[model samples]
Target: MTIVLGFEGSANKIGVGIIQDGKVLSNPRRTYITPPGQGFMPSDTARHHRSCILDVLQEALEEAQIKPQDVNCVAYTKGPGMGAPLLSVAIVARTVSQLWKKPLLGVNHCIGHIEMGRLITGAENPTVLYVSGGNTQVISYSEHRYRIFGETIDIAVGNCLDRFARVLKISNDPSPGYNIEQMAKKGKKFVELPYTVKGMDVSFSGILSYIENSVEPNMLQEGQFSCLIDRLLLGGQETLFSMLVEITERAMAHCGSQEVLIVGGVGCNVRLQEMMAVMCKERGAKLFATDERFCIDNGAMIAQAGWEMFRSGQVTQLEDSWITQRYRTDEVEVTWRD
Candidate 1:
């Protein structure tokens, strides 16, 4: 029985989780939320994570009913995130590994999401659509690697949504994306927005720019253009989500995959899930997804990926346990998968 404690502070969220074998023992997290019309800076995000990481770690351990000595390894998200936040979590992970005298594994943030999604949804060898605040990619496993089939040429889908939310001066308390989702539900009309899908890849920056330019100064004034704002929010979401679905379907067709699994933070969006489900039904495929618990960034994903890597004899030497901000999904070898 292998027990792993994982740390994840990739972006605005800090989390700690424990996993034993294939089961998640506990997962606890804290988010660093910025005010409306603002996005979180790396330094500020790191500070928030540093202030609450220990408390979250304690909560995780207590909830999991485990001791330091009982854990066999310590794992953390090593990359593809903000520099300050990644480094903050890496430092904690390294310190704890040394203190516990256990092996350390640096898990890729993307793979962590994929592994956790698979574990929770029981989907085997499915084509994955990973969409989040920092990344957007359509991936499928091939020859010991998670190969990217399609990706965003500019900003990610979630980033696009979050930025639009800021333009609307919406609350970023729970999340800009969540607020946008709620606003979109009330929209009864769809205004035409830029739909940029180039072959297998999608681009969201153009759409964002179009919407931003369309939002005249007068729209910002209180109680003015309320109906237009609603249409833009809903239209923007539908347009962006349609682009995602198009690329995902193309990837699935190319790979001949019958199962589709959506991972990462933005995967929690009900509209995205529904759109994918419709596409899946048309293609005669299965759509597998998880709720916020596993869909959003959390430590349990890192723990789950670490468990797989550790079981496969992968470990990080102390001197080489460094973090990177641009780690690619295809860079890591999928040793645990056949």
Candidate 2:
């Protein structure tokens, strides 16, 4: 009968969600979008979150048809995100906890995504490929932690895509990465790009730099390079996704896992899901994925993870509820899972 209210604003989006036990009662979010050729700044993103968080919280409660006193606990992302945005969300979460007289819990953003994926897809003990604007990692549960098997040594895959979008001056309404994915579908040719995978880890910065330096200046002043842009977009996706698949396969083999679950914002990309599905089929493994609803960052994920933790007797004290910008997936004690 436990109910939890969760807040998430680790990056450009702010969300509020209500969860009762394992079922999500409501999940609502708002994204802070910048114009073309620009990435969101931390301060601006924080300001956007601060402006809309209260409204979103009201929306969540109304959608869930629950009163504030019905909630048993409050949860928020404790970070591994933009510092200002994370702090903004944490402030609201703490204020609500105190005003409502509820216990507070701090959750890892990565674990929130993982828990949400498992909840929506029902994949047990699967190898996880977590890709987002801020993170990229291959993980599996070992002993008591979600151990990282491989990761990006430089920028994340989604960050690489967003930077490339800026070079192309594409729209960032929904997201730069989403626009890139749509453009890539129209591509007919493949342009060679750098493929840098070191052992189990992958690197994306070199490839992004190569594209910006080598191909970006070739476009005509009148923007008549549509075909070339599509080619480059598709080629970049293939190369980067191949690198991810390679590392994920290696980790799956090492861990003897027969199931794969993809989580995070980039997991919403159809192309990445298709590529992973191909590998999963070849290896005779099952693939589990969620749509934009669960894949993209949201507060329901935080609530879900917090519900698990609270049920297992894990709660954060008010003095220790501060955010950590570099919180690793493996650092959480994972007391909820056997």
Candidate 3:
């Protein structure tokens, strides 16, 4: 049984995991949540990542009761996230590999989420609707690839929620998505919000502007668009989350798959799961969801993917390994199948 240690410093979280064969032995995360009123700054985010990666890595090793030298291979997220965060993981992995002479592999962040969900739920071939603050994609497994049949054309689903939450003056702690989910429960009216779905590709920039500007004028005139804002308060989050659920259900139907799998950070929402459950139940299709522990950005998924690849002798070299902020899921051939 080969043991693989994975590091994920993509986005705002630093995650580390240890996996043996296909079993996830340990997974831990350290988060560097942006305080408030700040977008992702490469330098700042990278520094934060560097600080957390060591902690999470140590935590994973401790949880698994193993040392770094015991790891047969080391894997890290190579890109599709902030450069600073990417560099943080790369530097550590590079140092560790050089010291211990372990095989180092760089994995794609997006595919890591999908593969982790597959490992957790044992889904052989399920259509995927992965929605996160940074990404929104409708995926299907085909021809040794997880193809993106549909995705966000502009602005990720999670970004839309974060920005909208900021407009609503909601706290940026824990997570913007979680805050929106809570607010939505208290929301009453369903004020109209832009819903744009074009040819399976979604866009949220227009909708964001519509809400921001519409409320801006109201606030200037009558002190606030109190009533209009109230309509959107919790109501907007529910509508947006519901819209995503509806789209995923439609995409699953289009794929003609009997099983649909939900992955990514947003998939943890109970509301999202409830909506998909009802839709899938009506169609006699199976829907699988990963728990919060496995959902969101984490190293368990990376370790899981690395374990499978390691078994097939698929490994990366330290000399030519590189990070990409735009890596696609279908680029690498998957060795595991159901």
Candidate 4:
């Protein structure tokens, strides 16, 4: 068996996985939550990746019961991520590849999510609603390729969550979305908020503006991280989070997809998953939610995507491949497409 060691040090997570054929032997992820106004910034993500690389990689190898010598190839996410973080992963993979004398492959970050979503849900050719800190896209298949039917013109769904969490003085220490999710679990009363979508594309910047200007300042900054304290301290977090659930459901509705697949870390949100479940059932469609490991960034997904690409002779050269901070879903040439 030709084992592929996958390394994904993109965004806030350090994902390490070992795969043979198409199966993941291990998919461990270590996430980093940036301070407010710093999410996905190159420098911030680099520090996180640097801090966790060795441990995360070792854990994955251990879980797979394979040594560095056993792997046939090393795969790492190469583009469409924070530059410094991408470089950090590249450095590790390059060094390992040089030492092991193994082949190296650079994978696309977004495609990893899609590939892993396909693996977990067994959804072939289903429409993908990929939303997270750096992306909000309504995608589907057409002409043998993944197409973006609609997407965010600016901010990503998870980024909005983190920024809003900061408003409530929520610490992203463990994870910002987790903090906001905790608060949303406790939030009650439908605090009115902005929901913006244009021609199937969604916009969260408006909502961010509304929250920053309209909501009371975060308590921790001046008082504490409770937006609900302005009204009722009880169940405020739940209420705020439910609002996000509602918005996502609304986006799904706007897409009119019967087979809805949600991918990304925030897609692991129970409330969000529940909301999608409810809406999908009501619409007579199925919703596939990747488990937490697949939901978060992971190297296995990158390897899965890379394997597909490699088989199709889509291997990228080090000279031609550069890190992309703003790659659109439509930019990739899908060789696997019909």
Candidate 5:
């Protein structure tokens, strides 16, 4: 029974977790919250992660009831995230590995989400819709790689939503996206926004720009604000998710797969899940999704993916371990999958 301790500070959230086999023992996370009108900057987010990581790590180990010496390996998210945050967590992970005399593994952030989803939901070979603040991709496993079937051409879905929330001066306490979701529920007026889908790829920058410029700032009447927010959320999500479902179905048709897995921060959206469910029901396919605990960025996913690599005889030397801000899902060689 091998145990892996994972660190994830891919973006605003700093996470620590312990995993054994395919099960998560403990997952603890903390997010950096700024003011209502401001967005999370990388430097500030990195500082937040650096300050809270040790506390998160200690709590994770205690919750798992394991000492650092009991850990067989230390894993950290290696890429496709903010540079400073990733570096902060990577340094801590390296120090832990050195102190504990355990091997280190560098896990791909996107693959971590996919592997964790599969482990939790038991979806063997499902088409994956990975959507987060920094990433948006339609992916599937083929020839030992998570091949990208479709992706975003510009800003990601979560980024667009969060940026819009910032324009509205919404509280970033829990999350800007969550506030948008809540505001969208009360929206009744349907305002048209640019829907850009070229082939398999989707673009959201135009939509965000349209919303920012066209929507008047002083239209905050009793029900007017809620109506506008709802319209934007419902309409924007409908357009975006439709493109996602279309591309995913096309990939499913090409691969002849009957299962779909939604894994990433945006995958926790109830409306997105509902749209996916309807699409899957029509195609007679299954849709697998985890709750916010795993869907949002967490260390358990990193631990799970790293453990898979570790079990497959993969290890990153201290000298070779590095972080990147632009690692793609297909760049990873999926050794554990057949």
Candidate 6:
């Protein structure tokens, strides 16, 4: 049984996971939350990760009941994330690898989410809808790569939501997005927002601008605060998720796949899942999505992807270990999958 320890601090969270021969042994993580109406700064997030990394790793090891020497390989997310946090985690990964004399593997963040989703849901060759604060892409396996059929042309879906939440001064304890989802449940009316879907690409900055400049101020002036905000939240989600379902269906049609797998942070939204379920039911397709624990960013996903790469004889040299902020999904050659 090959044992792999993985580190994932791509953004605001520090995660540590242990996996053995494709089975997850332990996955521990902690998120850095800012005050209401504030966003996470890259430097501060990196500092938070640095402070909690050792404790997170120790907890994961203890939970898995494995010694550092038992790990055959060390893995860390290498790209497509905030630079400061990524670098902070990579430093820890390198140190651990050097101390334990274990080989290192650089895991792509997006592929980790996709592979972990597939592993947990048992969905083979599904068209993937990956939506997060940092990324949004409709992908499918083809020609040894996860090809992107659709993606956000501007800001990501989760980012749009987070910024909108900040405008409303929502608490970021669990997550701004989660708080918005809860508030959206009370909405009954539908407010019109721009739904921009050009070709397979989506755009949310326009919608966000409209919300911040026109909608909120108008509602506040009209003295319909609670109802208008609820309407905006719910209606915005409905419209955005409709676009997601539409693009996902189009990608599925193009790929000839009946299974739709939802991954990444925003994939945990119950409303999105329900919308997707309806779409899949109508199209005679299957919808696959993991719970919040696996849907959001975590070390288990990185460990799962890294373990596969390690089995395929993939290793990252210390000199070649570098972080990237713009790593694409198709850039990684899926050698572990047939």
TM-score of every candidate: 0.98, 0.98, 0.93, 0.86, 0.97, 0.97
In the range 116-179, model 6's lDDT, one tens digit per residue, is 9999999999999999999999999998999999999989999999988887777998998888
Find the 10 residues in a row with the least total lDDT in model 4.
Answer: 230-239
Over the stretch 141-232, how does candidate 1's per-residue lDDT look in tens digits?
99999999999999999899888988878899898988888879888878888899999999898888887887776787777756755567
* CA-lDDT, candidates in order: 0.93, 0.94, 0.80, 0.73, 0.89, 0.91
Write the number of the candidate with greater TM-score, choosing between 1 and 5.
Answer: 1
Backbone clashes in model 6, listed as residue pairs:
none
Candidate 1 pairs with clashing backbones: none
Worst lDDT 10-window in candidate 1? 222-231
Query: For model 5, what is the C-alpha lDDT against the true structure?
Result: 0.89
Candidate numbers sorted by lDDT from highest down: 2, 1, 6, 5, 3, 4
Per-residue CA lDDT of model 4 for 1-338, tens digit only, reads 66888888768788888887788898788877665545456787788888889898899899989888888778888777778988898889888888888777777778888988988788876667777777767677667567776777878778777876666556777777766665565554555555555656666787677667755544346444445543322233334334444544555565565777888777787777777687778878888887677887888888788777766766556565456666666777788757
How many residue pairs clash per model? 0, 0, 2, 21, 2, 0
Counting only residues 3 or more apart in sequence or on different chains, how many pairs clash (N, Cα, C under 3 Å) in candidate 3?
Answer: 2
lDDT of 4: 0.73
Model 6: residues >4 Å from true position, as ranges? 215-223
Off by over 4 Å in 1: none
Off by over 4 Å in 3: 217-230
Residue-wise lDDT of candidate 3 within 39-147, one digit each (tens)? 5577877888776677777789999999877899988888777777788788898888888899988888888888889888988788898888788888998877888
Pairs in clash, predicted candidate 3? 80-325, 133-158
lDDT of 2 by residue, 1-338 (tens): 99999999999999998899789999999999999989999999999999999999999999999999999999999999999999999999999999999999999999999999999999999999999999999999988899999999999999999998888888998999998999898888888889999999999988888878855455735566666565569899999999999999999999999999999999999999999999999999999999999899999999999999999999899999999899999999998889
Alpha-carbon RMSD of each model: 0.9, 1.1, 2.4, 3.5, 1.2, 1.5
lDDT of 6 at 60: 100
Please provide, for model 5 over 20-109, each residue's C-alpha lDDT reduced to its tens digit, 9 standing for 90 to 100.
998899999999999997888889999999899999999999999998888999999999899999998999999999989999999999
Model 4 Cα shift for residue 166 (angstroms)? 1.6
